[model samples]
Target chain A: MITTIIIYTLLAGCLIASWVMSREKTIKASKMALKVLVKTMPSLLAVLGLVGLTLGILSPQTISSLIGTEAGPLGTIIAAVLGAITLIPSLVAFPLAGSLLRAGASVMTISAFVTTLVMVGVVTAPMEIAYLGRRFTLLRNLLSFAAAFLIALLMGVIL
Target chain B: MKTIKRYLPIIIIGLAFIALAIWDPEKADASLTVSRDYLKEMILIIPPVFLLMGLLEVWIPKDKIRSWLGAGSGVKGALISVLLGTLPTGPLYIAFPMAASLLGKGAKVSNMILFLGAWAALKIPQLVVEMKFLGPEFTAVRFTLTLIVLVIIGQIMERAFTGRHEVLWEQPGESVGQKTKQMGTKR
Candidate 1:
């Protein structure tokens, strides 16, 4: 909600400022915006569909059931993979991780889930690649996937 | 057709929905609902973001952008990137275009990497939720560790992928809202 407001505010401010400075430039900017939007639309739609399917298939109940049964390095790996692939909002995901933890998920498992849930975005990769290029998108997500596991293991050691 | 190739993913997703519908109507319905909600959110946010990026490209001078976020902007630039990123902005998809624009405007790859990283993983609201559910200790540790890892990853990426060499920013005529040197020099 706040994010929506902030984005609108920023957009309005920038639009007004650009218009006041130069109407021609403002018009040109709007055209640029349109062009970029059109270019990105296909990938954006793909990402949205993928997100829907992944979240639908891996409902929270199913995830909890799947993640809670295991309790070792393999469990952590599963948790990381789940996190990497799924795009759960933090409001739901953090609490879900908490419950999973309380219900006997290892610290490493929950940590892997939380870290990868934020860092590695398999679902959003199409949109990311559209803007950031395939090489950059691939490298960032791949590195983030590795980083999530490392962070999870270190968290397991520390806490 | 070229257009068909471009829309391949969407087409594949459509087929998948059809398969899901046949295999499990309930799951298909749920998926459609989720996709609808997401499409609504995207519709609400994406246009304004693109417009804002457009305006930013037009109004913000390349020199000013370089001074603040360029390769030489150093630690201060990196700190600013994190600060800008951690704002209660929309999702990471929103950040991708903005980060790309910044890169085109001569922002350091390292800083943009941090910007995207922070946008994704370390927003304040997200951290609060993490602390609430994951415990203060767990949140703090992950936060600090993630920050350190982001810096390292940013540096590694900057070294491995020379920012200017990347083809992402090679669109002709306009470079982040400003005309290129050839046109400017000719003018």
Candidate 2:
């Protein structure tokens, strides 16, 4: 909700500014936007499809069951892997993490899940690479993945 | 063959959908529903985001961007990068183009790295959700640790990628040489 409002507000502001400055530039910008959209369409569509398939097959119940039953260190690893690959919205993911925590999932496991869920983007890598280049995407994601584990470990100790 | 190579991922996804439909219709329907929801969200967000990017690309001069967020901007530049990043926005994928834009305009790799990291992990709304679900203790600890990690990661990546910026798929309207020059590519 806030995201929508902020984005639309920024877009409207920029569009109006561009229009007032020069109609030609505004038009060119619009065309550039369209070209980028088209260029990235394949990867976008691919990511959407993959996210749907993953979420559809691995229902929340299934995820909880898998995470809830496993032991600590191994469970945290699985959670991290699942979080890295999956693209659950934070709204949905947080409550799920809370529940998992209450249901005996370790702080470490839930932290790993939440951290990687936000930081890493195995599913969105194609779109990321398309926009930011392969090496940038690879380094960012790999480093974030490593950082997520460190965060999880520290969180496990502290809280 | 070129077209095939380009769309191969989409094609594979299509085949996967077909396979799911044949093997388990209910699962396929569920997947389609999720995809529909995602598509709707993307449709609402992507156009405006891209347009805003377009405007940024056109209206914001490279020098202006460099002065504000570039290599010499230092600590203040990094703060601005985080501020720009933490705006309530769409997914992490949306940040990639913006980050690329910043890069093309001479933003420090470290600042851009910070931008991407903050955008991914430290948005205000996301933090609230984290606090709500995980408690202040967990949230605060992770937030602090993540910030430290991001700064360290940023510095390392900046040093590693110091002069190697030649990559395919040029931004619209900029010549390859111009881009190479702006990014300080050795070649």
Candidate 3:
């Protein structure tokens, strides 16, 4: 409810701002904005759909079972690697990670996954390349994946 | 041919999702329902985001951002990038395009990497959720540890990769938004 309210308020502000700004040259600005909106909508919709489905299908318990185990060193490594590969949006990943933490998933695994989920995106490669250049995007992701693994390993060792 | 090349991967991914849905209709339906719930939130969320992004694009000078965030930048700059990223609300999708735009304008690879890392690793909203669901200690520990890792990784990337050489920025006249504009103009 709060989030919704915040979003609505922001939307109202944006509408007002756009309206005021558009008054200077209403038709041209409106047309340009609409044009940009139409082009990006499909890709944006597709990404949102994928994120939604992934969240829907994977239960906290299931996610926990797969990578949340405290199977000593091996489990931590698996968790880290899996975390690197999987991409979860922030809105869902944190709550889910918190749930897994409650359900006995190691803090290390949850941390690693959350880190990698944001840092590395194996799935969004195409969209990323389209927006960010391919070489920069790919290298950054690869480095992030490695860093997630290292963090998990260190967390496993320390915590 | 260009269109096919551009959309091929998305098409493949979509087909894969369809296949998964067909393979288990029950699971697919459940997923779709959950996705719809999230989508509703996203729709509500996205419009303001679009406007904010537009405003930022207009207001923030790219050169100033680049000097601080550009390749081979200082530790202070990298830290600043990370801090800015950690404070932001919303998902990586919102960040991705913005980061890409910055990259086009001369944002450093290390800064972008740090931005992506910190954005996902340390979200204030997610932190609140973590504190509520888990505990303060756990959230604090995780945040600190992730911050440490992101910084260390940023340093490593700086060392290993020559950011100067990498094609970090977008080429002239090739923005995703620009492409869309051209398409619209044509129509």
Candidate 4:
């Protein structure tokens, strides 16, 4: 698939760049990369496990029906708002969105969910505040959330 | 105990999600499978993107980039930040960490807001996907409306908050250098 090819190509490019950027010996750079891999592994595994469990339980049809009905537009808005409030990881959000798409969910709904999944983060607030001051984090997320809702609404109206 | 108290809300939220997953184990399982596929896809796409980001971090001079992006007092900086964000090819997760780094360096609140807004509202890949699933007209309208909303929302944010915090422009290494220069002058 095109997506598969793109992913492989990006991975190859990343590896090459990592190789080229090493000022230290190749071995040291490789070791550092390995360290990063190790550090991220546990979290990655937990995410994988959660994702696997979620897929085993929820049917795409159910999610689609929920977001794609006469009441679907309202449902879509609420979902988008909720998605913004909840900080689901990108790894988890995409497949869920993809499944909803496959199950005949409206493009509007999926788009809204994906946008909010990334843009608004009620959960990451403290971390965001600590990193980028309180005013910046709060205002940016508020704006992002509003933008996401507008994007979804327009998509529904036009599409 | 102190650390737990600080993170209590996050902990509670996580528990609630887990509880939801448990309450309907079968539904959770299906969702998890889809989520796994998504994760794999993300893994495939993210590394190279991160590499390019790292390259940008190394190459782009923070202050130079910041001056143009700083305080959304004017339209030019806001528009530039939004455009810059629209062009990037990755998910929001990747953008956040990098944006945080930029904020540490001298990137203004408006620029950061623009980046986050545009990144979320207008991704090219997602647009193409939308076109395929919906149609061209729909995608165009959504894109236009989203852009307008982001700008308006950004302006509102700029007006509402005025407290200038020290963390807004805390670049690493520069302060140490400044301190050293001051000490030298004093001596």
Candidate 5:
């Protein structure tokens, strides 16, 4: 919330400064902003809705049990799915994952959780596609999904 | 038809929510709450970010981007990408537009991947929190692994997905179109 305020203030200051420097450029710039907003609106709403549904269905308790039930590849896959689908902030995610780790979850499971949580963003795909187009967004997510899985296995072994 | 197709994702999700409400109101309520909260954050943050990206397109020279992050940039470009990504910028989604603009301005696909990877998996503040909660060893291990894998992934993507791209916010009079912007291939 504070971040939002600071960003808005910074944005306002920058807009003002730009307007003072070049009214034409500022207008041109904001015109593009409007275009982008219009182009990306449906995707943005979809992201929000998907995030809500995923998080609602997979409560923290449910997530813990799914990731904690098994110590093998299955658990890691479950964790990865949970991470990819849900957009948990690092602040909340770290503590929850850490507690799960202490509560007998395998290092691989937690690694998969943390890695996919950051690397793969299924819920945010709509927004990604809006900006980056379908090909780049799909490739990035698929590749990151593979990388996250591999990294989890390595972390499980080494740590 | 195109309009409905564009809105299909949200429409499907909306139906899912309605079904959940009918079958189990409690779960539906929880989902709506989470969605509402996230919507608030998105609405608050997106405007400024988009405005900044617009300003960036106007202010930053295309050649500068080409030289700094293009194919010829090599190792230095990766370093710069990581540095740019690690800063406490906004969420991962915000980076998507910025990355696209940079790519349009001739950023290497590999470097952009590094940038996105660093932004997503390795933000500085997020690392601090990870170290505090998960201990230094765990943090150190994961960070190193993530960075290494990201570099590898970036290199692979650089090779695999090289082609023309659609530049959305081109100059004012120009409509959106595919730009055959092969970064540094001419050189």
Candidate 6:
């Protein structure tokens, strides 16, 4: 809701200002936007479907069951993999993590879930590759996956 | 045929959805519901995003962009990138095109990493929600650790990519990325 408002408000502001400045350029910008919209459509649709499938199969309930079902290193690894693969909206994910915490998920496991859940995105890689390309996506994600574990491990040790 | 190849992913997903609907209608319904909601998001957000990027391309001067986010911009650029990332409330995928645009416009690769990392992990609104669910202490510790690690990752990535030459920022397309990959192998 807030994102919608912020983005549209910015868009309206930019559009009006640009119109006042140069109608031709604003039209040109709109054309550019349309071209990009067309270009980005296929991958965007692909990602949407992929996200649905991933979340559908690995629903939050299923995820909680898989993760934190055990505790210790095994649990952490399970949580990490689930987190890396799944693309839960943060709104859904945080509440789920909190409940898992209450329901016997260890600090280590929950932190790992949250960290990798945010940092590493296996599902969205195709859309990312569409814009940023394959190698950059692979490198960034691999590095982030490693960083998430380190961050999770430290968080586990500390709090 | 090319169109079929291009739409193969969607075609495969359509099949999967159909299979799920036949096997378990409820799961298929849930999946579609998720996709529908995100479709709403895509419809609402992507237009403004495209318009904004176009305007940004037209309105912002190249030199100004360079000075603000270029190789020599240093800590200021990184800070700006993080700030840019945190202010927006959206999925991580939304950051990809914006990051690509900035990279094409002379932004440092390391800084784009920071922008993306912050957008993904350190979003302010996300943190607030995280604190409500997780504890403040947990959020704080993870925030600090993630930020620090992202900067380190950014530094390492920039060095790894930029080591070869000015291959990355000179061109602004995925083909260049493939070239970088090929170059990395030759080295």
By lDDT, who's the top model here? 5
Identify the superior model by TM-score, candidate 5 or candidate 6: 5
Ranking by TM-score: 5, 2, 1, 6, 3, 4
Residue A101 Cα positional deviation in candidate 4, in Å, after optimal superposition: 11
Give per-residue lDDT, candidate 2, residue A16. 85
Clashes of each: 0, 0, 2, 22, 0, 0
- The Cα local distance difference test for each model comes to 0.86, 0.85, 0.63, 0.58, 0.87, 0.84
Clashing pairs in 6: none
Candidate 2 residue pairs that clash = none
Cα shift from native, residue A17, model 6 (Å): 1.2
**How do the residues A4-74 of candidate 2 rate in per-residue lDDT, one tens digit apiece?**
89889878888887899899999988888888889889899988998899988877877888889996789
RMSD, every candidate, angstroms? 3.1, 1.9, 6.1, 7.0, 1.7, 3.7
**Considering DockQ, which of the candidate structures 3 and 6 is the better prediction for this target?**
6
How big is the positional error of residue A117 in model 2, measured in Å on the Cα after superposition?
0.3
Highest-scoring model, DockQ? 5
How do the candidates rank by lDDT, highest first?
5, 1, 2, 6, 3, 4
Better of 3 and 5 by TM-score: 5
Deviating ranges (above 4 Å) for candidate 4: A1-59, A70-76, A82-137, A146-159, B2-22, B31-59, B71-76, B160-187
Candidate 4 chain A least-lDDT 10 residues: A32-41
Lowest-scoring 10 consecutive residues by lDDT in candidate 3 chain A?
A24-33
Superior by lDDT: candidate 1 or candidate 3: 1
Residue B99 C-alpha lDDT in model 5: 93
lDDT by residue (tens digit), candidate 3, B149-187: 777766666565443332222333456466435323432
C-alpha positional error of residue B138 in candidate 6 after TM-score superposition, expressed in Å: 0.5
Q: Distance from true position, residue B164, model 5, in Å?
A: 2.2
Q: What is the per-residue lDDT of model 1 for residues B1-187, given as tens digits with 9 covering 90 to 100?
A: 9999999999999999899999988988988889999999999999998888888877788779888998679999999999988985578888989988887777877898889889889998889888988899998999899999999999889887663324233344745424334323322
Tens digit of per-residue lDDT, candidate 4, span B28-114: 655556666757765775454444444444445756665676543367777777876887655555556456556544555556677
lDDT of 6 by residue, B90-156 (tens): 8788788888777766677899899999999999999999999998999999999999998999888
Error of 5 at B23 (Å): 1.7
Off by over 4 Å in 5: B175-178, B181-187
Clashing residue pairs in candidate 3 (N, C-alpha, C atoms within 3 angstroms):
B70-B108, B71-B108
Residue ranges of candidate 1 with Cα displaced over 4 Å: B163-187
